[model samples]
Target: MSYRGPNVVATSNADEKTPAASRDNRTRSATTDFLDPLTETEGLDLVGILSSVDETAYVWDLTTGRLDWESNAAEILGFDDTRKVATGAAFHALIAPEHLNSRLEVFSRSVGADRVRGVPYRLQYRLRPCGQRSETEIRVEDQGRWWPGADGHAVRARGVIRIMHEEYLEQQRQLVRNDFDELTGQLNRVRLTDALGAVLTRAEREYQPCAFLMISVNNLAVINETFGIEIGDQIIAEVGRRIRSKQRGGDVIGRYSSNKFGLVMLGCGPGALRVAAERFIKAVRETTIKTSFAQMTATISLGGVIIPDQAKSVHEAVNFALRALDIAKSKRFDCFVAHEQLPPAEGARLRNKSIAEGVIAALDDHRMRLVLQPMVSTKTGKPEIYEALLRMERPDGSLVSAGEFVPIAEQLGLSRLIDRRTLELTVDLLKRHHELTLSVNVSGLTCSDAEWLTTLRRLTAGNPDVLRRMIVEITETVALEELDQSVNFVDTLNELGCRVAIDDFGAGYTSFKNLKRLNVDMVKIDGAFVKNLADDTSDQIFVKTMIDLANSFGMETVAEWVGDERSARFLKDAGITYMQGYYYGMPFDSSDYVKAA
Candidate 1:
C-alpha cells in the first residue's frame, strides 16, 4: 500500500498531541486494500473497476500533504500524466466558479478535524472543461468518505468521481422537451399553466397588475385545407416567432395550443394590456409569412383581461380571455378585445365566474333546487304544464334565479349537471303528482353528449308514463345549430312518448323546411317579441306569424314573458294556445308548489 502526492495536508492542531508512531500505524492500516490497485477482493476490486470506467478513484493523505489520483482522473481532465491534474487545487479549478464553494464545503466536512466518524460526503456539480466557457460545463458526481487515525483525527479522504456530462445533458434535454412545445419551441400547455400559476401568485403577493392575452390565428383550419397542413404549420411557426419578437422583456409567452399562444404580461393594467394586445394583433396581421409552397399574411384575434381584476386564477383569466377572443372573432378580424367592465345590472364576466364557481359548489353539495313556473292554457285559462326552472341556494342563504345562472352554467359547460338534476327532480315531481305535467329546458349539447344521452335513456326507460308527461324544451338557437342531432333527439323523444318543444322560437332564423323536419310538438315564442306584443305592431305581427306557422305545422304555440294582462290577452286573441310569465304566476319552488296544492 502506498500514498503519493504533495497536495494533501497533515492532521492539524486537533491531532498535534497524537504520537507520530501511532499516526503512522493508523495511516498504514487505513490505506491497505484501498491503495492496492491489484487487490481482487469484493470491495477492493470494486474500486479498480470504477477507476477503469469513466470514474476516477482519489485519495487525499492528510498527514503527508499528498494527493493520489488514478489514470482516469488524468484522462478526464485532458492530461496525459496524473501529476498535471493531481494538485489539490486542480480539481477545484475544474468546477464551475459558482459550484466551487459548495464543492469545497463538502470536502471540508468530510476531512475536517471536527467532523465525526461516519459522516457522509456526497456532491454533484458541473465542471468547466478547460478552455471552454462556463456555459459548456460538464457534470461530475462525487462520493467518498474521510478515514481517521487511532487518535480520532481525520488523516485521509478517499472517494470515486464519475464524469456524468453526457448523461446529465441528456436528462436536461428531456426535461426541456417535456416543458416546451417541440414544433414552436415554446412552453406547452402544462408548463404554461405552471408558469402562469407562479406569476399569478407572485403578482398577488406584490399587489402588481398582471394580464393574460389569448392570441389565436384565425381560420387556421381553412389554411390547412387550402394550402396543406405543412403550410399551416409554417404559418403557425411564423406567428409564434412574431409573438416572441413583440413580447416585452419580462412578459411570458407560450404556445398554449396548436393554433393559440398565451402571453402573461407583468405590470400591465387593462389599458396597457389593451394597447399591447393591439400591437400583437397588428404585428401578426402585417407580417408576411413564407412557407414552402405559399406566402401569405395571417390575421390574429386577441382577447386580453387584467389579472385579479378580471380574474383571480389562471383558469378564470384564460376563460375570460377566450370569451373576449370569441367576441372579437365574431365581431371583427385582426382586432383586440379586452374584457369590459359593465354596469352591475349586466353581470359581467367576473360575476359569471363567481356564479359558475358557486354553481359547481352547489351541485357538489346537492344544494340546487327546482322551481316550476306554470304555463296556462289560453283557451281553458287553466295551468296544464309547469315549466321546471333551476335555482341555486347560495351559502349566504340567498337564492339565485334561473335566468342569472343558466347562461353562466352553459358557458362553463356545467349545464349538463343542471339538466340532469332538473330531469331527476321533474321525474320525482311527476311521480308524486300523476296528473301533473312538466316542461324541462335541456341544453342542445345534451342531445349529443354521450353521458347525458345515456342518463336520459336510463331515466325515461324506467317509466314510460313519466315520458308522456314530460315536454323537453330545447332552445331554438341550439336546435338550429345542431340541426341533425336535434332532429334525431326529437325523434327519439317522440318514440319514448315525450313531447319536444322549440324554445325561444323567434330568436333564431330556423326555416320552415327544417322546422317541419324537427317534428317537435310545440313552439315557445321567444320573449323578445312577445314581451312587447301589446304596444308594438311589428312584434304583434311577428307573434301572429309564429302562431300561424306553428298551427300550420300542427305544433302548438306558447307565448313567453306574457308579463301583463294586455300581453296575455293579445297573445290569446292572436291564437297562442299557452302563455308563460308573471301574468300566470312567478316561478315557485317545490315546497311552495306543495303548499299551494
Candidate 2:
C-alpha cells in the first residue's frame, strides 16, 4: 500500500491516546487474513449473506490512505469487477456528485481513526455498458452503512445501494401521488374526482340509492377570525375524523375544499335522506375535541343529491350532489339546504335552469302522478289509512317513483308544486269516495316555509274532511334536529286541523333520552326492528318495548315492514296500533287506494 497524495490529516490530540495504539497492535497480531478482497467481502462470516449484493464490503489500506481491494464491491457500484483497472479510485469515480463532500469527510475520518464508519454510501451512477449506447442512461443507487470490524482497520463494508435508493424514490412518488388532506389524512378533492365515476357505476348496477353530500364546517370563517387559522384547521381535522367515524368503511368521503367535505351516501333512498342528513350533521357537531390552545366544538351544514335512479350515470349524480351542496352553502351557516330545493335567490335561477324549465312543463302536461301505498291499521286487519306517494313522468313516458325524483324536485324548489298536485289528487279521490283517511309525508324542510305551508292550507281550504283525514308524517329525527324551528311548524299544522305523526321513533342517530322530546301525536318504529323480528329475538324485544314505551307516552306505535302474517300477528299482539308492509298492499293510485281502503 502507498499514498501519492498530499499529507493526510492525523487523528486529533484527543484520539492519539494510549488505548487506541494498544487496540491497533491487537488488530495486526490477530492471525486473520491481512487483505483478501474476496474473504473480506464474501468470506467475512459463515453466512453466505455477507457475500450477497446487499452487504457492502471493501478493503481499505491505512498506509496508502486509499482502498487497496474491493471484492465484488464493483457490483454495488454497477459492475462485476472491482479488483482490476478501476482499483482504488474506482469507488470514488462512482461517488455521486452530490455525495462527494460527505464521502471525502468519512474517508478522511476513517484513516488514522478508531473506525471506517460507513460500509457504503448511496450514489446514482450509470451502469456498465451492455451494448451499443442509447440516448437514455440506466442509473440506480443502493444505500447501506457500516460498523467497525472485530478490529478497526480490518473492516468489511457490504450492502446494496440501488434498491434502497429506488425504495426512497418510490416513497417520494407516493407522497406526491396521494390525495390526502394535509390536515386530516382524509381523502381530498383529487381523490373525489377520481373515485366518483367508479362509485356511480356500482350504484347503477345494484339498483341502490347513492347520495352525494357537501358538508361545510359551519362558522369556520368566524373561527379563523376569533381564534386563529391554526385552531380552525385543527377543528376541521377533528370534524373530518368524526364524519369518517360516523360512516361505514365502503362509503367514499373526501375533503372537497377547505372546510368542506364531500360524502357519497350509499344505498340510501329518498325516504331516509332527511334522517341521513341530520345524522351527518350530528356526527360533526357533537364531536368535542380539545386542541393545544382551546377546547373546541363545531357544527356542520350539509346539502346533498340522492341518485336520480340506479340507472343514472356517475357524472349526473356528481353534478346533482354538487348542485345540492351549493344550495346548502347559500343558506344559513348551521343548516343543510338541498341544492335542488333552494328558493328563488341569487344564482338559484342559474342553478335550477334545467330542472325548472322541465318541471313546469312536466306538471302542465300531466306528467305528474300519485301512487298510494297502504299503511294499514294493526287493530282492524283492514287498511284504515293510505300513504300518498308522489310520482313524476319523464318525457319518455316513464314514471319516476317519488323515492326517485322528489328530492330532485325539492332541490329545484318544485316540492310545493308537488305537494299541491298530490293534495289535489288526494282530495279528488277522497271526494269521490268516503271513510278513507290519507297520510301525506312532507319534508320537515318545508316546515320553515310559512308561505308554502299557508299555501298548502289555503289550497285545501273549505275541506275540513280532508284536513281531519290527513296524517302529516314528518321524520322525528328531522324535527328534533331542527327543534327550535319545529314548534311553529307543529302549531301551524294543528291550526290547519292536521294530525302530525313523528315518523321513525328510535331510529335517530342520537340516543333518545326523552321519548316525548319533540311533541307529536304518534311514533312510527323504524322498519329495521320489524324486518328482523321473525328470527332476531332482540328485534322482537325492541319492537315490544318501543310499543309499550310509545303507549306509555300517549303516542300511537306504527310497526313498518310488517311483511308477513306472523309479523303482523306478533306486532298486533305486541299492541302496535298501525302496520305497513308489502304483505298488506303495495302503493296504489288514488282510485285503487280508495277502493282498497
Candidate 3:
C-alpha cells in the first residue's frame, strides 16, 4: 500500500511469507481484526444512541474537505433533512460571529496538540447555526480523532456533538435560587454576607470607604399578632420594595433576618452614609403597607457604622449596627444611630461585645446570679422586700452588673433568657427563705414576648407561694410601649396573688397617661428623678408629683437612688412609702443576705 498526504506515511504489506515477515504481518492483522469489531460495535451503539436522543453526529473527511452529519443535524440547525452535509467553510459559518475566531483557535490548538501527542481532540464552543433566522444559540461539545483509511491516503475526523442547553439553563436556575431570597426576591443572608465581605475587602484594598446598616421593621411580632402573619409578610415585602426603590447605585440590600434587612453602601463616607440612612428611614416610614387585612403605616429603625475603619470584619460591622439598633429601639423607633454615637473608647465597645458573648455563655452555663437591694418601708421602718438584680459571674471570679449587660442582652434578643433566669433564681430564693420578699425586673421587650409570658405562667403554676412573695417589676418604657399586654400581665399577676410594680415609673414620657392603665401594687419612681432629689428643684417636683400620682392611684410608691440620709429623709417626708438606694444598703448576694437574716 502507498499513501501521499501531508499527514500520511507510506507502508508495504506485499512481502512474501518469510518467517519474520509473517510474524510482523500477523501481529498487524491481529490488531486490525481486534479493532474492526470493536469500532463497528461502538459506531452502531453511538449511532443508535445519538438518533434516539435526537443529537447530532458528524465526520470531517480531511482529504476531501467535506463535513457530513447525521440527518438530525439539519433539524437541529433549523433546516430541512436534505441538507445533511457542508464543506469546511459552511461548517465554520455555523458558529456565532463573535465566537468564530475563538472557537477556531481552540479547535486548531486542541487538534494540533492532540495530533502531536497521538490523542483524541475534544472542545466545547457556542454555536449559532447558520442559514437560520431564529437567533437561538446552543453549546456544542465536539469530540473527534484522526482516522486513517486502508490505503493510508485518506485522513478523516469523526466526532459527536451534544447540546448543553438544558444543563446551562439548570445551572442558571440554581444560581438564582441560591443567591435570592424566595419570599422577598432579595439577596439572601449568605450571599449578602459574602457580597458585603467582598465589598469591604475591595474597599480596604482601594483605600475607599463603605457603610453597613441593619434595618428592622419595628414591632413586627405585634403586627403579626394583631393582624395575621400574611400582613406581616406583606409589610416586609413592601419594606424591601421601598428600599430597592430608594437605593443608590452600588448599594447592596439583603434580607438579613426574619424582620431585619441589611444595606451596604460602597464608597460612602460617614456624612454621606448619615444622609443616606436618613433618606432610607424616611422612605420606609412614609410608605404605607397595604395588606389584605388593612392598610397600615410602618416605621423602620436603622443602626449601622462605617466599614473598613470602624468595623474590621463583617461580624464586627454587623455587631456595631446591632448595638446601635439596640440604642435606637431604646430611644424611639424610626431613628438612625451610628456605631460612633456609642461609647468612644475601644475598651467600652469591647466590653459591650464581651458582655453580649457572656450573656450567651451565661444562659448555657447557668452562671447568672441574683442580688438583693433592700427596699425599706417607711411605714414599718424595715426592709420588707428585696429587688432581685442580675449579675453575671465572669471567668475571672468577678461579677458583671445588669446595668452593664442588660441592655446588651436586650439588644441581642436574650432578654427572655434573662427573664427566665431571674424567675428560676427568684423561685429558688423564695423557697429557701419563707420570710423574704423579692422583686424582679423584666424588660418591656420581655413583657410582649410570648415565651416570657409562658415562662411566667409556668413559674407561678408550681409554686403559688412564690407569687405571694414575688413582685414583678415591668419597666415604665415597656409598660407604655405595650400598654395592653402590660395591663394583662399585671392583671394575671394580681390574680395569682403576685404583686406588680411599675418600675422606673417616671422615665418614659407617657408615665402619666399609661400609669393609670397599669393596675399595680407599687410604683418605683425612676432613679433619674430621685438621684438629684436633694438639690434639683425640678427633680424634687417630678418625684413629688409621681409619688402623689401613685398614692392617688392607690399604688404604694418607692423612691430609688436615695444616696444619703438627706435624700432618704426628703423621700420619707414626701410620703414615699418605700426607699431603695445606696443609703439603705448596696446590692448583696441574695443567698448570703437571706442566710444572714
Instruction: List, residue by residue over 491-557, the lDDT tens digit for candidate 1.
Output: 8888878899999997897899999999999999899997777899999988888899999999998
Q: What lDDT score goes with residue 498 in model 1?
A: 89
Off by over 4 Å in 1: 1-353
lDDT of candidates 1 onward, in order: 0.78, 0.65, 0.76
Q: Give per-residue CA lDDT, model 2, range 88-139, as digits (tens).
A: 3334444445644554454334443445454445554443322223332345
List, residue by residue over 1-597, the lDDT tens digit for candidate 3.
Answer: 122342211112222223554434543342233234754665545444665655666665555444556545666545433132244445665666765665344333422233332336666777766543547767777775655454432356656677767876588689989998988999999998998899989988999989999989898999999988989999999998898888898799999999999999998988998899788889988757788887899998888888899988887888888888888877655888888744468757686678788888987888899888999999888999899899998765689898888887788788878888888888888888888899888887767677766776676675778779999998877787777888888887788788999888777865565777787899998888888878899998888888888888898999888898888888989999999999898899876984556
- Number of clashes recorded per candidate: 4, 21, 0
Query: Regarding lDDT, does 1 or 2 come out ahead?
Result: 1
Q: After best superposition, candidate 2 residue 221: deviation in angstroms?
A: 51
Which should have the higher lDDT, number 1 or number 3?
A: 1
Pairs of residues at least 3 apart in sequence or in different chains that clash in candidate 1 = 5-66, 8-65, 8-66, 9-62
Report the Cα lDDT for residue 428, model 3: 80
Best candidate, lDDT-wise? Answer: 1
lDDT of 1 at 388: 88
